[model samples]
Target: MAFTFQINNELQFNHDEELLKKAEECCPEIKKETKKALHLVKLIQDQTQLDGIGTSILEKDIDQLSDYHLKRDDSLILDFGNHYVGSFSVDLDQVGSPMDAPLYIRLKFAEMPCELNAESQDYDGWLSRSWIQEEFIHIDELPYTLKLPRRYSFRYVEIKVIDTSPKWQVVIKNPTLITETSADYSRLEPLSLEDKTLQKIYDVGLKTLADCMQDVFEDGPKRDRRLWLGDLRLQALANYSTFDQCELVKRCLYLFAGMTAENNKISANVFVKPKPLPDDTFLYEYSLFFISTLYDYNKAHPDLAFVKELYPIAKKQMDVTLKMFTEEGKFIPDEDYPVFVDWSNAFNKDTAGHAETIYVLKQFISLSHLVEDEDEHIYTKALNQLSNYAKEHLFNKEKHLFVTGENEYNIASQVWMVLAHVMDDETNKKIMNNTIEQLFPIKNIATPYMYHHIVEALFEAHLDKEAIALMKKYWGKMIELGADTFWEAFDPDRVSYSPYGSPIVNSYCHAWSCTPVYLIKKYILNSK
Candidate 1:
């Protein structure tokens, strides 16, 4: 329940059977499709492609995949044409002389070609090497099906022979990925748009969301398959606008509510496999976002019964987070429970965190009214205090921007404050204009999640052209760099930046980056 759970296993959660049962009942049946390898390709250095790695489609036909024979040290790469979350398998047979030695091979699954450039053994990042999506196997017999049990999120699978024997070679054929997803692409209603770029951005964004959808709305199927609260908030918004899969959103909400700590503090994320369990990770804004997620869900697909069912758990998040703020309405960043404004801690987050609190408190108060919580005034007062503090203390009138630690004015501070609507309409526009003039050509900050906030803030300030331009610049650049789907982090200035010290660990199709669909639907399509 507290930070003590880090060292001691004193953490215990209340598993409401009814809520957990509803979560189980709402688990969407995972749909699967058998996809054959589309083309054979070789990875080569190309400056134009992502991470300076591009694929040259081999002349060989995928229909005759077995025709190619590989000797020891030979490797083959199969391009599946599109991104998918699934398990991979291929028929492996021996060629020439009798099977002498065991067939030792390494299979590396990559979401991007650049990831193939990163050697798993060379990956020295802080993230677990287990998440590299590489597997080493030894086959004692010939004519092996070689069906890997582990599911992988990838479009390229590289098979490298370590040693098959000097006498014989290996024949690879029938490479197939049993794709998994709970999202129904057929359910997407077709729409007409004039701007091709925005249309493409929305399409790619939808694909990104679909790829990440599973038993739960996973942040990244390739990596942290856990259901993160922060990702859930954004994914729910996008889902409402796109697939409209309310059951999945409700399942996710109930899961978070069902697995809360004894103190009713929701875990930042939850592990869904081997039975559902919550992780010890807790973020300040993430926990508070539970209320926001529920509020958005209700607005998109209203169900008072559902709102009432989860109201107490949602209310607890606001109640718990309000304690993090001081009597003076200043948010104190706790080392044990830090605010995750972005993955990068490169900037001061107190003001952004304070603004974020105002953002969630407003949502909490709205939900409080829906369920008729009599103590709604408590949340309203807290929201007023947080907003008043930001307007009075955090703003820099001279710069027309919000300042954080050491008098630093960052993009996040302004974006979240605008999203919170802490300032009036005219002031919000000035803040965004100043943010664009002073903070143009954004650098160091990477994460489509933050980019989504900035773009939405721009749109909210009635800067549609600026919003569209920024979206095209940031998200469109990912498309130019050969993103079949949007990436988790991309600072255009440093195209090769990775939080995990290697591009191999970066999520190319993350859920947080899928908000362009929501943004487009809300701002552009629904524009006056």
Candidate 2:
């Protein structure tokens, strides 16, 4: 499922006060820091940069920001030197004559220069234009500080003079952004890597994770500012590797556990604003990821008491998902509860869905052992059945890759099969090598989320060189394209592709794309 638009408002939910209280107790205190614009910049056409848009320095010091009086149709771009998620404020005053007409200005917050170059009026994407991060304001007084009330995620702030009186111009100064996040950078231990590129990748990943860590692990601080199950799974893994903030993970777990559907199924994501409420959207693999997340957390932190508290809820998720399988152990994907192996639905997901069942079932069984559940054998039997079915029906002997519905062989099926360990290590390596030979220079798939799985599967298969190569090729390309932080979607073949049809709405710093830290630490640095 692409996750474009989904609404299931008819579903009933249970808000358990006990779990909600635990969630509140674990809520993190957001850290705040003030950052000033580093330089004045203007957008210029450059085919090398993202969307063929690059920035040029204005050669003016940030201290002299107030000297440049802006009249009608004038504009200035403030470069913060790096990406950040926060609120912005600036001091403004009149320059010449008395304030006659109201100063109508438009402020645009952009994560990249291309976003500043793109016009919101030209945006015809299906996503809500309200998420454009551009605000229009009219100031009637002079020497007043215009502090925006909403939080934004960006690295560039473009102030455009929509209209100003011919008698007077506007003077702007002391533009400040209050950066916000719940991540404690002081706790980050310095890691020295001989490989500079890997170090850079790790650092970027850490920043991406830190920015997304607010009261909860948001998918993106910009758009979809909420906790998603699939994104949470990857974010928690990266959190364990880098920040290791177990309390935030615990808080997120309780939020999910507190508000499941009436049928005990977990929602795809949850909203934290008005209150802790689960979204109506649901994904089969995402719901199963709840089990995988709990398993990974218990492994990282070893909280037996906490595991016991959430084990039953996790088990219920497993039970409901397991019901989607047939007696032959083949997963029948429900359109109502889709399997989100990747955003592209062009490929069949049956093989990926079956492999995902095997993946989460293995983790669930490990949790069952922690709680010493009596029904462990039932899960074990299901795992065996699913694995056996995959090995027998999905694996193509000649192609040396997994096949999905109607013998459709794609990268996702192969990647998920390797990750699930549907076959032995030697065979898994062969499958991955075959996938590279057949599916090299991947096409149509544009998400870092899917790319993360492919890279991790390479590591799991002991194809370290291949794994590092793919990471550098995919993530390094983002850095080359001038990304201070990673993006939600990027297709090397097509740099301008957006699931939302326009880059204006795409999340530049998504949580799922922050897995390089986890990968480098676990695979390259070999850190615990």
Q: Rate the local accuracy (lDDT) of all candidates.
A: 0.90, 0.91
Q: All candidates' TM-scores? A: 0.97, 0.98
lDDT score for candidate 2 against the true structure = 0.91
Candidate maximizing lDDT:
2
User: Model 1: residues >4 Å from true position, as ranges?
Assistant: 1-8
Q: Which digits, one per residue and each the tens of the lDDT, describe model 1 over residues 88-198?
A: 989999989999899999999999999999887788987788899899999999899999999999999999999987899999988999999999877889866799998
lDDT of 1 at 35: 97
What is the number of residue pairs that collide in model 2? 0
Cα lDDT over the full model 1: 0.90
lDDT digits (tens) for residues 188-216 of candidate 2: 89988888888788888889999999999
What would the TM-score be for candidate 1 when compared with the true structure? 0.97
Clashing pairs in 2: none
